[model samples]
Target: MRSILPFALALLALPAASAQQQPYTPPKHTAPPPPGIARSTPEEVAQQADGGTQIERDRPATYALAEHRRLTRALGTLLPQRKGVVDAYVLSIALDSDPVFGREAREAGKVLARRYDAVGRTITLGGSDGKAPSPLPMGSPANLEAALARIAEVMDEQEDVLVLYTTSHGAPFGVVYNDGNEGFGAISPRRLAALLRAHRIERRLLIISACYSGVFVPPLSGPQSAVFSAAASDRSSFGCAAENDWTFFGDALVNRALRKPQPLEAAVTAAIAEIATWETRGKLKPSLPQQSIGVEVQAWLKPLEARMPKVATAPVGKPSVDSLQAP
Candidate 1:
């Protein structure tokens, strides 16, 4: 499995303080600084004095219109929302190029879709195994925003639930997005909160698999939302090797626990226990995955849970923790 060393180093390099501050939306006339130059001054250092004039040069790639059209077509495939029914629209995305996340996204899409009766209303975004051409759109901040907008447009926001599963590397600031050197971006908790709020998507089940993902829980948690994170705000989850089919959290929750005909809460409990055992055996510090289910969300979640398949499926692939060599 991939070591957490590189991920930890990357987190140390990020300005985690940005997450606590208000985002700086560049003025309409201000253009993103040209590539190949970062910044001579610290971002946000002089925000109040300069009226937020500073800019971080490493802007995310603004992909061609063709990419937008591709996502549009994918959105079009979703079945129209059913009136008077509590439907679930599933969106599974892998924000990083690592094959493990991609594989997890693909399988997560299938599992969530089936479990939630969202077979024709599921969208999967990520590369595949790093071998075959990806049949889905690459996951990025822009694409994710576009997808959510599209789902909002087609679904009944009050009655439908948004099942969003994002797998990636993360820092205290946000979930990182990197796609084979062509894409780089991040989705912070505030940014995501704004997106959902803007779309009026009240009911949501968000499962984030990433290091330091617990940062999202506080901002996104609400009476109509359930947030489950792979790691605590200050911790890093393991099993991120590129060649593997699943990360530790993905395997524990999606591959094993959720595969059974249990309630979501029960599944989460089982996954947590399983992960703890694995971590202890490997002599590793606990990642301390977190979960929060809103009180109001249960009213709608029960109907969705009632539709789950009774038969259980066997887990596939090697256990993620098994890759950890003895300490």
Candidate 2:
């Protein structure tokens, strides 16, 4: 991410004639999203009946209208769904503007798209470098909702699956969205569950790479879903430095495990073990990644797994974690 201190200092050094330009757009929230959204249940969310309007919404940045237009065109480009096929619609997002999250999202999208034969059905959102002008639209809650709305309209609910991968910073409350200083918001467990239900997306594979992301597993997981979290509810995952390419959980799971031809269950098992090895060697507190797979998911999951490339791709980028001292 852009260094906050230097960003502020640069503003102070700007020429007086050009000082009117703001460094970044300020967020519209008067306060952070309400606490306790993590504790809400599906029934409670359904009763509200506002489709997540209670939470702080992600608004368009006035300065990034071109990026907003790109989002519109990106959604427009999604190929029409194929009939009688188990088409997977993939939505991979980097909610935070941190370069690490961006890189992880982009790579994860490629891996998933190839695995599921979703080349024309994938949408990736995030900047490769947090400071540069990105060709893709920056990730945000509103953008995600829009993508889902479109996918719901096109895909056959009975034959298709939604694969969502989100990588970002997090809190016990929810996944964090920090697009530099230009955008901010959170997607609580309640909020995400509500979105999926509203879109009628029943078959899903939800992989969340963020601190304390286990909070999502309880509300969103079911007989038709497979949910994987980077850490337990109270723990923080590692390897999210702005200069790095992948977070610890992401590198282990998407970059390494899932790239091989294996069942989802086996891939998750291997990733958890790999993450544990790294944490043990580094002498850091274990993040304790979590997974929940519905028994019913296997009927369709097996077919998709069978389609995976026979040859695994070699991993790219520096490893997310390493032994601090020589083993």
lDDT of each: 0.81, 0.81
- Once model 1 is optimally superposed onto the true structure by TM-score, how far is the C-alpha of residue 121 displaced, in angstroms? 0.6
Compose the digit string of candidate 2's lDDT tens values, residues 1-119. 76699888788778763855635322222444344444557554333323433333344556458867989887987888887678889999988777888889999999999988889
The lowest-lDDT stretch of 10 consecutive residues in candidate 2 is 24-33
Candidate 1 per-residue lDDT over residues 198-236, each given as its tens digit: 999989999999999999999999999999999999999
Measured with C-alpha atoms, the lDDT of residue 221 in candidate 1 is 96
Q: How close is candidate 1 to the true structure, as a TM-score?
A: 0.81
Candidate 1 to native Cα RMSD, angstroms: 14.0
Per-model TM-score, in order, reads 0.81, 0.81
Q: How many angstroms is residue 294 displaced in model 2 relative to the true structure, after the best TM-score fit?
A: 1.0
RMSD (CA, Å), each prediction: 14.0, 8.4
